[model samples]
Target: MWRCPLGLLLLLLLTGHVALGAQKGRGRRELAPGLHLRGIRDAGGRYCQEQDLCCRGRADDCALPYLGTICYCDLFCNRTVSDCCPDFWDFCLGVPPPFPPIQGCMHGGRIYPVLGTYWDNCNRWWQAGNHSAFWGMTLDEGIRYRLGTIRPSSSVMNMHEIYTVLNPGEVLPTAFEASEKWPNLIHEPLDQGNCAGSWAFSTAAVASDRVSIHSLGHMTPILSPQNLLSCNTHHQQGCRGGRLDGAWWFLRRRGVVSDHCYPFSGRERDKAGPAPPCMMHSRATGRGKRQATARCPNGHVNNNNIYQVTPAYRLGSNDTEIMKELMENGPVQALMEVHEDFFLYKGGIYSHTPVNLGRPERYRRHGTHSVKITGWGEETRPDGRKLKYWTAANSWGPAWGERGHFRIVRGVNECDIESFVLGVWGRVGMEDMGHH
Candidate 1:
């Protein structure tokens, strides 16, 4: 004889009704767990149920045909391994379904089933099973690769502190750009290729601009990040990754030649391979100066003159102070957290989206990266909301994001870009101007 547990019997007694099938099927039917009837609605226009649908005496034979599958109304269906019909909660337990309706997400005039994802350029758009829309890298092969910029150690973060005090009643402009203020002086963005050496790229970029602006445009040389990548090897991993403080230290102590001299050699397919041999070398020329020992790597250009910078200084986290430093001086270096979605950045004042908030840990990956903050501005949205942003130059080449530049939300330290800002002075001399 079939026996029902006391607990299940108590549940059956409380329900007061059980609608058993008229005929007992030959064999038990199996259905996928959590299956629900789609396009089927009730009196309340809900998809799960129409009227009372229960079972008689914990019967496993009690089933309803739904969308070519069978769903159970039996009391046993509500066990730890539940395989109850979607309407079981409403008709049997007087409660709503525990999960949302199984529905496809509508996007771009097409319906995507739960968890469907597709990539458009660098951006990945996904629709979760709950019908929620999100934009980020999916759990695909691309997520395996990490971005550049290692998080600064405490020793690196504490080096070279320099503060800028705001003058009393000296109001700053609503917008500013180093390129506009110092036309033809600021270096255009350079491509880092597959190298993860943003530390070198950003340092060289800032130093190049500062040197040009400090020298009054008489010597507007594009300083070489490749020079740093190949030669600055003391406790540093070339191309793989390195610290910004160490990069600046190398710039101050060893110095580097122009891009025309060393030239960038990072290949698009060789990110993990060993960096090329340090082609150019230099010797100290006495009294805190040095000169290149070898010819330019490009061979056509002979200008192998070494450029240097003063000790890089850390700026306060204040946005106004950062703006003042950028306006009064040149482009400043800043470290930012590059979330997976950042790779998809096309335009507009970028703020890290919360679309990936409830995702798995693997899908929420990020890495540290450095950029040059050129200027800032504010924009009023069509809905009257004000958005402030900092214009920055990325080393990913001109093909990406506003022609090698991007504007991210400022003031609130979006992605921690304002946290570890830095500035430096070009160690320029009369001899540097004579070369021009």
Candidate 2:
């Protein structure tokens, strides 16, 4: 008679699979307590299905007596012990095993588990087939959360067509940086955190540099991105995402306060929450000018003056035009498609690598992002190949690539960065620079 031990019966009852023989199927017959024999196609030797063994409970009889030791087909067998049958996953779970028989990965002369990951310098190295170990989230999540610049609208695109032609005879230098050329004028890059507000951050950074340069370092004020994020509501989705044209439009019309006055508050809000209310407002001060109508959000600094920018102009895709614009006028904003691998950028002339292209479409995501193109240069490689690159400032903070800056392949419109370049003039009158 088929009889289960008291301990085995208690375990089966706890697992809620006590009625073992009740399941009538392909020649199912109880062999010993929880152990049952079910007819399966004869592949070769006795496997999980051949023994009619697919255990759901934690019982001693949930295993089949195999060569010398027992092999378990129970659900919890592989939790602490690795004594699962060869066909346990296939027969019991109707799915393939987590990995092939050859487990663990080989890297740097050491064997790592299937999902092992490590950091080499700034870049993260992960075992093959372990995508989540690198970025903590999937590519889709990165695109949705990390980036924010939306594709330019038709009007913004048409603006690029109306490029400000520069003098072709102007002899440009091999390399130049706005910070080096105009020290203390260009503001360092600011961290946007996880909020997808690069639109506001980039615009604020470019405007800050331009204003400082235009005023001859007299009004070197770091503008507030939070002012743009909360205030620029016209066709703008503050933290979630926004367009460059809308950002520039807000800068030209509504204007923003200095970082000391308004400051950035996007980091404080929930990642997916609505933008905070506009803390600072302005009123027309005659002759196309604006004055702050409210006190500084930060009470310490009594200066609540509004800073405005003239209508932004577009630069040609030609590297020379961009260089000239950046050299003459402070920093310029460039829109680029940020791919998955960009988040891993450390320091180098960055180019979208095809390493992750073989991944599924969901893992190879890209999103639009705006950055401040500060300068450009060329470097001769060991192979005598001269590679040109654009020195741009990202809004991911100082800890990121090259102390808040990065270099990308300059020519060939790499990543479409050179496709749409924009420059703006700060509306700094004599009175605006009177303090210095």
Candidate 3:
């Protein structure tokens, strides 16, 4: 046997498998002692695809094939094993397991636990084939512990329950509506060079959405594009990104002035000229404690794509049915494509995949065409595993484009982008576009 830490070993024995220590430094990965895996498969559908081996097949090899239902006992097939049902976020939000197995997990956002606990010991299915891993806490246990509740499909929505706790009469629609302090709505693409205020950008967008919806009963004129190009660069501690919530706070207090008044009178070369270092005056800078980069905000559902973040709060409950009812519906101020990541398939920059339709469908014609909704789904998995995912439509391109559509995890992986909503990032108090 190999040497293990202190309490970890005990927890492993009591549970079932040995939990591999995530290494920070560089060195060879040593397998845990007595870690017996069962039916593990590799990218070739025979054995485990050693990291050394897969690296060679990088560009060519997508990933391993499906390792059908594994009846656990060790780590995920070729991997090691664990005892306790590891934290859901730990695995889902963080790193994932090996190839083939992970491929399925990625598709459905089913972040399985390390060597499962006793009942449905996640460990038992360590190397099993094709079956969704049934690891970690059971449905009943979670409710008892007050951690989460089971939705219609068996998948657990911990945050949803917490969010709904205070509101007794809260309906599904209530939870998705715009919040207070919206100002910067950005359905269009604004060059970052034109602005550096990511906080201002998103805040304006939310404000625009709130104003339009509240006044006109639907989303009004599309907001400007130039927004949130610097908050993440200067004040925040990350790549030039922004958080919608933080933007909201700034809009409420500091209040963003119009670019017309501030005029980005920069040279052609210097598009977004750097202003004095960002001075976060509002106690509620961008998102939270202003670090360096743009992070996500609270109540957000996904971020992997754009369609998933489509402006649903603006539409009434029967909006879809009504739209279906009336074939005469025409273009509005904007169109939302709610994919896993909140991206607008604008031309020039993000046009990796142009509209496949030979005819340009007039997305750029009137003031109405702006957003589009792609992926959207519930919070459960097919195997009845407790999962939290983002449902969005994807246009991965004609290559892997499934009927010009795609869906992915909402919170974990790249999908966690719920913070891009109108109230969350756009502006409030603008003209409304009548919907209902």
Candidate 4:
């Protein structure tokens, strides 16, 4: 038998296995250069580095925030990409990832190889190494697809507009108040000092309230995360950054909020205990502080904001049932959805310094600038002093998480909320909701 060059033979084998795998599925390029070539990805969505030797290129999950690398061209990569990109949802929205019909590597540094890559069944140009742009956008596209596709019911009101137009002396409902029923009580732990997760506090309070309303009757209000974080709402001028207490007031005025439209800043994270008074010169003073939390419930971004709210019992209904349930439980925790592109700021509150969004000069964190209802409020370090704040949680995981799990401010801060809080609004669920 003729002896072939060992290196050459290995390359062919790696290439062959890559091909076989893709063919097995629809078409997935192997993630990278290989040894076994069948390496598995881990919790961080990465495979072991010991298995392959890939050609150098602009890696999606590479340097800095990238943490590690993936062989963009490994077997079945095309298949994986197909399964993820231009998904059913993306197809509906005008913005879909390029796949199958347009196969090819578009590496950051202009390196599109002819031999190492091939566009598979979907007609994509995939290579032996990974093409993160394809992978990353796939998830985003999927989400966008969902947003673009989910047919909105005529009854549902646009949350963004509602948050902006809310006025003081308004009333809505809690599940219990709406149904004119009593609510159950379920106390949870507090997460003291943890910053980024404050949303959880607000969310939990809301959810618990909902469950209580659904389970029992009208209940008392819980603490507010926005108040605790020194970030609350002022007017709908967008990200004016006020105290958390205002969140409840904002919600009372408006039934919901559109977290997708507005962008926020952590410019004053360290200024503790309610953000400075609104910059909206000559603003009218609002009423009592009962505490609160608001929900964005869309997009994959983690951002914080201040808000205001007025106190009132309410019961809410509609697509916002989830938010409504939580809101009725009293002030709860909430979290802006976490995204891969952006990180949450915990080192301080939203004052003095602007939360770093990676780019120094730009100073603006990009992405949907949207929001989500990720996790709930968890109280950590509640031992009176040491670790005496509430923690929040999100679907995004630890890295994007600031504080501990997550956190939100409480009490006085709930007065000037920016977004709308969902719940039974002074017998709202029982109310006509104007039309629906």
Scored by lDDT, the top model is 2
**lDDT for each residue of candidate 3 in 306-417, tens digit (9 for 90 to 100):** 0001222222223232122111111111122222111211111110112212312321111101122322333332357643322222212222222222233333323213
The best candidate in terms of TM-score: 2
Candidate 2 lDDT over residue span 1-436, tens digit each: 0111222211111112223333322221322212111111111122577768887765556665432234567876655333566457666887644322211222332122222222223232221222221233444555666678999878769764445565667688988998899998988999887778999999999999998999988898899999998999888888889989899998999889899898887453344555589999999988788999899988899988788999998888888878888988889999999875566565667776443333335445689999999998987755567778999999888877778788988888989999888999999888877885
TM match of model 1 to true structure: 0.68
Please state the error at residue 216 of candidate 3 in Å: 2.9
Ranking by lDDT: 2, 1, 4, 3
Off by over 4 Å in 1: 1-146, 269-273
User: After aligning candidate 1 to the native by TM-score, how far in Å is the CA of 298 from where it should be?
Assistant: 1.1
Runs in model 3 deviating more than 4 A are: 1-205, 217-221, 225-246, 253-376, 379-388, 391-436
Backbone collision count in every prediction? Answer: 0, 1, 115, 166
Can you tell me which runs of candidate 4 are displaced by over 4 Å? 1-139, 142-338, 341-436
lDDT of 4 by residue, 1-436 (tens): 0111232221221123222122222222433332113221111111212222222332332211111222332223333442222122122233322431111122221112112323222221112332222232332332332111112223332333222222366443312222222323433333322133233234334543443343334322333433322333433211221222234454444322212212222322234454333221112223422211433322463322222233533222222333334333433322222222223122211111122222222222222211222223222322332221222333232333352233333222211111233333232232222221
| Candidate 4: C-alpha lDDT | 0.27
Task: Give the Å error, residue 282, model 1.
Answer: 1.2
Whole-model Cα lDDT per candidate?
0.69, 0.70, 0.25, 0.27
Give the per-residue Cα lDDT of candidate 1 at 353: 50
How many angstroms is residue 236 displaced in model 4 relative to the true structure, after the best TM-score fit? 18
